[model samples]
Structure formats: C-alpha cells, structure tokens
Target: MLDLLNDLLWGKVLIGLLIAVGIGFTLGSRFVQFRYFGRMFRILGASQAFKRDKHGHLSSFQALLLSVAGRVGGGNIAGVAVAITLGGPGAIFWMWLVGLMGMATSYLECTLAQAYKTAQPDGTYRGGPAYYIARGLGQRWKWLAALYSVLLLVTFGFGFTALQSYAVATSFDDAFGIPVVFTGLGMAVIVGLIIFGGIKRIARVAEVLVPVMAVGYLLIAVVVLGMNLPRIPEVFLLIVNSAFGLEPAIGGSIGAAIMMGVKRGLFSNEAGLGSAPNVAAVAYVPHPANQGIVQAFSVFLDTLVICSATAFIILLSGAYDPASGADIGGVALTQVSLADHVGEWGRSFVSVALLLFGFSTILYNYYLGENSLNFFSESNVTLFNLFRIAVVVLCAWGAMTDLGTVFAFADVTMGFLALANLIALLMLFKPGLRIMRDFDEQIRAGIRHPVFDAKKFADLDIDPAAWEIEPEDIERLKRYGAPPPSASQPVK
Candidate 1:
C-alpha cells in the first residue's frame, strides 16, 4: 500500500506540478527572490522595527526561529545524505536551485498568511495556508483549505511526527545502545509538556535552541571543511559539472542530480510545502511582507547555509564514492562521514544533533496539526490535544519500524498537502505582489511606521487607535533610506 502511494504521489504528475509551481512563482514575481535577496539581509540587519515591532506576538526574529526550527531538521543531515546516496553529488545543485526559487514561494505563502490572519479571543493570532487559501483565493474555494487541514493533521501530526521520533530514537540507540522504547517515551513526555503550553512556549524554546544548534553544527562543519580545505574546489566543481550532465566528475547522468536535488531540497526548506506558512501566520508584525521577508531569508539559511554546510562536509571528507560502492543512506552515512574526520565522538555528536533537530521539528509539526484541527472545529481543543499525543506514540513506533515504508508514506501525504498549498498560493499570487508593492511604496515614502493592519473579514471589529501609524516612525523610516516611491530617495 505504501509503495503504491509513493508511486502515485511522486510520479511524473506530482513532480511536474511541484516544478511548475516553483517556476510559476518565480516568473510571476519576476524572480523577486533574487531581486530582493540582498534586501532581505539588509532589512533584517537594519530594521529597528523588525527588532522591536511586536504587537502582542512573537518578534520577527522569534517567528523566524520558529520557522527555522522545522526546516533545519534531520533532513539537513540524514535527508541530504540520502539524496546524495540516491541521487549523487549532482543532486546538490538542484537542491540549491529549488531552495533559491523556494524563497519566493515562501515569501508568497507568508504574505498571504498575514493577509488573511485572524486574531484569537485570547489576544493571539492564527493563520496559515488554509486561511490564506480560503480567504485570499476567495470563500467559494474553501474546500482547498479544508483539504489542506486534513492532509496536514495526518501527514505532519501523525506521519512526519513518527518519522522525527524515529530519527531521534534510532540515532540514540545506534550511538549509545539506549533502549528505543525509553527514548521514545522520554521524547513523548518532553513534547507533551511543550505542546500543552501553546505557541508562546514553543517560540521561547525555539528562539534559544535553534540558534545554538545551527551555530554549533556550522562550527563543526567549518572545522571539517578546514581539515579538507585542499579538496574544496574539486568537490564544488564536481557538484556543478555533474548538475549539467557533464561526464567527468559524476559518473551518473545529470537527470539523477536534478531529481534528487529537487526532492531533497524541497523537502529541506519546505518553502512550498505549506508547513512554514503556518508558523509565519503566527507572527505579530505590522506588514505581512515583514514576515514574508524573514521567511525568504529562512529558505536561504536552511538550504544555502545549513544544508550546504552538511553537503560540503560529507562530500569533502572523501568518505563517499560514486563509482564503486552502493549508496550509503540516511543518518548512518552522516555518522560515517563525520566519524572519519573527528573520530567516534563525531558520530555521537551527530546523534545528539539529530535528536535536537528532529525533536524541534516534531514540536513545530504538532503545532501545525493543532491549527489545522482548529480550522475544522473551534471547540475541539481536547481532541486536538489527544491527536497530538497520539503523534508522540506514532513517533515511538516510527523509531522501531521499517523507515522506508514510513518515509514513503510521509512523502505521499506531504506531497499531497504541498500540491494543495501550491495551488492556493498560485491562485493568490496577485495579492502577494500587491503587498510587496505596498511595502515598497511605504519604504519609498519614508513611512517607517506604516500602519500594517488590513482586515480581510468585514466581521472583524478592529479599534482604529490600535493600528495608527505614528509620525515619529516616519522619521525612523528615513534612517533605513527613503522607500522606492518616497521623495526621500537619495539624490543621485
């Protein structure tokens, strides 16, 4: 059954759709992901508003951390390793390309998320692909929203939750001989404690842990790369040459590289996966474009930075051979590569990284499922909790079972959800473009403190005073440079 589902989900139809959607977003936005690539970092570095702009929600940084918590997972390690094993080094190029294009997809989805966000009675916000798809795409097409909710609840909460648990449990057991059941139970307890506290607690935990884990891994990768410095240029040449079916470096055809890269890269950053947008919606910022900008940077961090770090370390270590050996797959391959450089301790460290990375992803995935459940029934909080707990148990089972089946099942479900989300995003691409234009206008006008509140629902009763833009903010905006349409433009 799982094999059949895999065949159907990953068949040419879905693969074509995924690629087409990515290109469509890139073309529709005129490759805004690239045009604004530098601006993304500039805005993040220079914006006092992004730093201090909190409206009773997570700061832009914290929201970004929350999004990163999911993207920077075992996929960077085990999944990337698997892509190389299955698709070869050339796959790395495709992954990078997909990630680049994915930034725009992330921006578009996040913009829509903010555009359709609904405030909760408890003074918080909730919105996601479903909300944007329904509201932005129009009420009549709400079935797309409903379908996404159901797919995520099962795929993420139930399916991928299990996969994450398995990664944690298996890594520990492989590294330290700890019982799998013990690991699973302990993880369940930790996750339950956090899920019960809601998004605030999740954000608090992620803000600290994501940075630590990402920096620590990058540091380790740098050390490994330093040790293999002489091989760096050759390894990169191989990745590029193989991407175009050049015969010398990679023995395999270029098609393998493209397929593997697309599959693994899309899985890595999850730009169009519809997962990150759920987290993006929770942010309390003035403009959806603010969070959208942050999310674009996240795709860069996930694939360009984190995933690349892992790929380079593995490739440069001289651990893999494309010609002779069978493909070394999953966390085990990463362990072997790291161990070759840093010894047995390296393996253990990868295990710990896997646990932290996978655990964070599980928590974020459950939160997405909870929101998906919320869309189905506002009063089903208890049921949502119950379903979430069940995910922990599934995670346990995932660790002790045949992961091929589990992974294949997850792909089927996630691919379906991603397709549904991509459709919604494409349908609402115009709204995202409009928001970007509005933000650009505000920036050019020297409107630093532009009012960000735009209500989608007529029933939503917002107080005018709460959303008023201040003149002082306009002065502050001047510091960032007059936005494109504003007369404060630097006199050329």
Candidate 2:
C-alpha cells in the first residue's frame, strides 16, 4: 500500500507539479533568485543580519542557519546514495536542476511567510503555509491551513526526525559496533535537553553547529576530489551522458533519473516542501524578500554544494558502479567510498559527520512541530509537553526499527505537504508578486536597504505589530528625503 501511494504521489503527480511551479515562480518574479544572487551575500554581511534585541526573535542570519540545519541532513549523504543506487549517476544532474529551479519556489514561499507572519506574546513570530493560507487566502480557507499544519507536524516533527535518528544510529552501529538502542537513547536524551529550552535554544545551537558540520563535510569531499583530480572531467561527462541516456547504466532511463532526482532533491533541500518557511518567518528583516532571498541561497548550499560533494565522493571512489551489480548503498555506500580514499578513518569521520547532521536536523524538525502545534493552541503547555515526549519516544523507536515502512510514510506525507503549500502559493501569487515589487521599487528608488511599509499593504491581512516601523528606520527615511509621503506618515 505504501509503495502504491508513493508511486501515485511521486511518480505521477508531484514530479510535474514541482517543476511547473518552480518555473512559474521563476518567471512570475522575473527570476528574483538570480536577479538578487549577488545581493544575497551582501544582505548576509549586513549588520541587521546578526542583530539581537530585547525581544527574543531571531536575527536574519540565525533564521538562515536554522533553515539550513533543516535542509542539510541525512538526505545530503544517505539520500544522495539512494538516488544513485536506484537512478544512476545521471540522477545528480536532475538534482542540480531541481536545486536551481527550487531557488525561486523557496523565495516565493518564504517571502509570503514573512509578509503574513504574526507577533507572538513571547516576542517571537509565527507564520508559514498555515498562517498564510488562512490569513492571506481568507478565513473560509482555514481548513486548508489546518490541513497544512497537520501534515507539517507529521512530516517534520515525527517522520523526518525519526528517520534522522535511524540514520545516525545505523551509522554508529556500522562504524563503531555501537548498539543501535544505545545510540537511540543517547540522541533522544540530548534532544530533550535542547527542545525543552525552546526555539531560542534551537536557534542558538543551529547558528553555531550548522556551519561547522557543513564546512567540515565539504572540506573532506574537497580533499577526496583533489586526490582524484584527473577523474573530475570524466565524472562530469558520465553524469551528463547518463542523465540524457547517452550512456548505458543501471536505472539510467530519463524517466527514472528525473523521478529519483526530484524526490531526493526535495528531500534534501526542501525548497518547495514548505518546511523552511516555518523558520524563515521567525527572522527580523526590513523587507520580507530579504529573508526569502537568504533561504533561496540555502537550497543552493544544500543540493549544489553539499549533496554534490557526496555524489562526487561516491562516484570517484568507484564504490558505486552503474555497470556492476552490487547491493552497497545509503550511508554505507558513502562510508565505503570515503574509506577507499583515506582508509578506516574516513568511515569513522562519516559516522561522526552524520551524527552532527542528524542531530541538528532533529533540532530543526522539532521546532517545526512545535510551531505547527502552536497553530491549534498557543497556551496549552500540557499538550505541548506531551507532544515533546511523543517525539522523543518516536526518535528512539525509529532508531531500532526497520526503516522501509517509516521512509515510505515520510515520503507520502512530504508529498502532501508540498502539494498543499504549492496550491497556497499559486492562490496567493499576485500578493507575493506585489511584495517582491515593493522591495524592487525601494531598491530602484535609491534606498540601499529596503524597509517594509505596512501602510502600503493595508488591503492585506498582515499584522501591524509584526511590521511596526522602528525609530531608527524613521531617521533613515528622513535622511533619504527623495520621496513624498514619508515612511513615518500614513500613505493617502
């Protein structure tokens, strides 16, 4: 039944929808992802990106790191191997395509998330597909919002985190002979410590650890690729040939390549899957598009940079042969390939890297669940604590269980989650376009940094408290004296 559902959802429906939506967003926004590609790095270096305040809200950079934590996980390593095993080396090319197109899709969804975000009592923010679907699309469509929240809770909160736990436990068991049960229990305990401290704690941890683990893993890939520099051109040619069926290899058909690449690509970067926007909404940015652009870069980092690293390591080591019939795959395939290059130490490094990746992802996934749960009830402390306990138990259970069923379940839920978000995005398309236009107009008008004016969007359902202009912003507007209807005054 699970296999049949996956076949129906992924094989037929989502592959086309994912590509079409990505292209639509890219064209509709005039390729905002690329237009502001260089600007993204500039925004990251801005002082606002790291600023914290009396309110415990996340800075723009912290939000980016948190979302990156969610994107770079077991999928970058183990999931890439699975794509190669089932879809051949050509799958890497399709993954690259998805990552590129996904940049636009991520930008649109996350920008909408920021536009519709609400201020919470604890001085934090809350928004995502759930908030936007209900508020942006009107109250009559709140059922759709509830549905999105439920799917997010299931997909990220339980299913994906459980899978992360399973990956880490299995890696330790393979590398150090550690029992899966012991690894599972230890991970669950650590998770409990951070989650109980709340979103602030999660943000702090992700900001510190995400960059370290991602850089460390990429450095290892660099060394391995450098050692085999002569084969770099050959590997690139093989990927392109296999992608177009110019080369004969296992699972080398164009259809299989497109399907597996897209599936695993979405799993890795989560561009249109609606997960990243949950954290994206938490950021404090002058313009909603600022955070959106930051998130689009994250998809690039996850699939293009990190996932490609894993692909090169596996393909270059010759541990994964399309011509040969061998059963090696997943994290083990990656471990074997690395070990081939650097001996047994490489295997242990992968085990440790996966532990950090999976651990950070668990932190990210748990926050998504908590945010979704808040949609139904904000003050239900009892229910919140119980949900946390349930997640901890699921983490431990997933580590010890066979993952066939769990993985299937996660794929199905993820498909539905993306389906819901894409529909909401399409419905709210014009408003999203207007938001982007607002930012563009500001930049074109000689404002070096765009600041959102809620009065300009009075027709929308945005919370004024979330976009209240700061006194510093008022001063900055005074300095720019070029436009009528100053930012401080209401637009007539």
Candidate 3:
C-alpha cells in the first residue's frame, strides 16, 4: 500500500507537475536563475547578503546556508549512489536537468515566501508554503496553507528527524562501536542545545560548519577523481549513454533512467517541494528575489556539486555494479565505494561525515516543523514547544527503532507535501514573478543596494511588517554600509 501510494504521488503525478512548474517558472522569469547566476556569488561575497537588512533576522546568505544544510545531508552521498546504481549512469543526466529546471521553481517559491513572511516575537522570521498559500493566495485559502503545514510537520518534524537520527546512530555505531542508544542520547543532547537557542543559533552554526564540511568533502572527492582522471570520459559516457538507453548494461529502458533520476534528484535537492522556503523566508534581504537567487544557487550546490561528487566517487572508483545495483543504496554503497578507492580510512571518513550531515539536517528539519506549528498559533507556546520535544524524542527513537515503517511514512507524507506545495507555487507564480522583476529593474538601473519598499506592493495581501524598515537602522546602514546591530549575531 505504501509503495503504491508513493508511486501514485511521486511517479504518476508529481514528475510532470514538478518539471512543468519548473519550466514555467524558468520561462516566466526569463531564465533569471542563469542571468543572475554571477550575482549570486557577488551577493554571497558581500556582507549585505549575509547580514540583516529587514527587521533583525537571518541574512540572505545565512538563509541559503540553512537551506543548503537541509539539502546537503547524507542523501548527497548515499542517494546519488542509489540513483546511479538503479537508474544507471543515465540518471545523472536527469538529475542535472532537474537541478537546472528546479532552480527556477526554488526561486519562485522562495520569493513568495520572503514577500509573505511574518515577523516573529524574537525579531526572527517564519514562513514557507503555508504562509504564502495563505497570504499570497488569500485568507479563504488558508485551509490549503494549514494542509501544507500539517504535511510538512509530519514529514520533516517527525518522520525525517527519525530518519536522520537513525543514519547518525547507525553510522557512529558502525564506525566507533558506540551503541545506538548512546549515540541517540548524545545526538539528542546536542540537538536540544542548538534548537533551544532557536533560529539564531541554527543559522550561526550553519554559517560556520556547513561551508567547512561541504568544502572538505568536495576536496576529498576532487582528489579521488583526480586519481581516476583517465577514466573520467568513460564514466561520463556511461552516465549519458545510460540515461538515453544507449547503454544496455546500465538499465532496461530510458523511462527507468528518467524516473529514477527525476525522483532521486527532486527528493535530494527538494527544489519545488516547499521545504527550503521555510528557511528562505527567514532571511533579511532588500528584495524578496535576492534570497530566491541564493536558494537557486543552493540547488546547484546540492545536486550539481555535492550529489555529483558522490556519483563521480562511486563511478570513478569502479565500485558501483549495475547488475546488483538494486541492493546498492544509502550508507552502504557510499562506504564501500570510498573504502575501495582511498583505503579503509575513507570508510571511517564517510561514517563521520554522515553523522554530521544527518545531524545538521535534523536541526534544519526541526526548524521547518517548528515554523509550521507557528503558522497555526503563534501565541500557543505549549503546542509548538511540545512538538519540538516530540521531535527530540523521535530523533532518538528513530536511531534505535526499526525504521522501515518510519521511512515509508516519510515518503508518503513528503509526496503529499510536495503535491500541496506545487499547487500553491503554480497559483502564486505571477505575483512572485512581479517581485522578481522589481528587483531586476533596480539592478538594471545600477542600484548596488536595492531596497524594497512595501508601499509599492500594498495591493497584495502581505504583512507590511516584513518590508518595513526600522527607522534607526536606515542611518546605520548608510553610515556603515552594513545592516544595524540587530542583524549581526555573535559569531559562532
């Protein structure tokens, strides 16, 4: 029943909707993701992108890091291996194409998120598909918002936390012989500390650790790939040929390759699934599209950079077997491939990497669920707090319990969440494009620091507080060329 539902939701329904919406956004925005690609690096390089610009909150770049933290987890390693293993090397091409198209989907969803975000009591922000569906669509459509929130709560808050903790526990147990129970408790403690500190701490930690871990992992992949430089062409041919059914050894047909590629790629980067926008909306940027551009770059980093690293490491090492690919998945394939290429130490590295990757992802997932709960009732501390406690408990349980059921539950819920989110994205696409155009016109006029004026968008049913500039912060930004003190946190 679970498998049937998943096939129906993801394979039969979402594949077309996902790609269509992505292509639509890409065209609607006139390929803003590409035209603004270089500006992504410029914004990232300047502190304006990372420092607060709106009410004191996470910066645009920090929000990107937060979203990337969610995107970069163990899936980059194990998931890529599974895609190539089952889908054939051809699946890599599909993943790349989805990553490209999904960039626009991510942009449109996040732009709406930023435009509709609510100012939280603690000077932080919270929003996502739910917030946008309500504010962007209308008050009457709030039920759809509530529906998306519920699905997000179930999938990320409960289901994914367990899955992540399970990965961490199993990896640590395999690597250091730490008992799953012990690892679970320790993991829970670390998570409790950070989440208790709220979004500020989560963003701080992501800014520091995410970049370090991602760069280190990629450096290692580069070295391994460098060693196999001669076979690079062969592996490339396999991935490309296998995708189109030109290579019979990799799979049975082109459809299988496309399905596996799109499925895993969509799942891995979460381009249009509505998850990243939860973090995206928290960023303090001059224009809503600023964060959208940053989030689109994140898709590139996740699928193109991190996921591709895993694929190359596996294929380049000659460790992946298409004949037995069905059995190759998750941590096992990653561990085996790295161990074969770089010595047994590579296996231990992967284990440690998975532990960090899964744990960071769990942190981000907690925030997503917490944000969902906030949408229901910001005044109800008891409920969202209770959900957080539940998340911590489930994280530990996921580490020790049989996860077959949990994984299945996660899949079904995620499929539904994507369905809800994609619908909202399509409906809200035009307004989102307008916001993007506003930002683009500013850039075209050579405005280095393009500030958004909410008055212009008064026609939209938006929370004015989101775009209102605090009076004191204006002079401070003019004087120092950075945002006010509230925007800067104590660096981790």
TM-score of 2: 0.95
Tell me how candidate 2 scores on lDDT.
0.87
| Candidate 3: worst-modelled 10 consecutive residues by lDDT | 483-492
TM-score, cand. 1? 0.89
* lDDT by residue (tens digit), candidate 2, 349-397: 9999999999999999999999899999985788889988988897798
Off by over 4 Å in 1: 42-55, 249-251, 401-404, 448-492
Model 1: lDDT to the true structure: 0.77
- lDDT at position 439, candidate 3: 84
> Which of the predicted structures, 1 or 2, would earn the higher TM-score when compared with the native?
2
Over 4 Å off, model 3 = 48-55, 323-327, 470-492
In order, candidate lDDTs are 0.77, 0.87, 0.83
Q: Identify the candidate with maximal lDDT.
A: 2
Supply every candidate's count of residue pairs whose N, Cα or C atoms clash at under 3 angstroms: 4, 0, 2
Q: Can you tell me which runs of candidate 2 are displaced by over 4 Å? A: 47-50, 472-492
Using TM-score as the measure, which candidate wins? 2
Compared with the true structure, what per-residue lDDT tens digits does model 3 show for residues 1-492?
999998898888999999999999889889988999988876666545337544456677788889999999978888887777677788889999999999999989888999888877666787899988988888889899999999998899988999899888988888889999999988888888788777888998998889888998999899988889999999888888888778876743688789889988999999889999999998876668778889999999999989999888888775677675456566788888888899989988998888778888999999998988888888477886687688779877888987998898799999989999999888887898889888877777766555666667878777767765656545544453433323322111
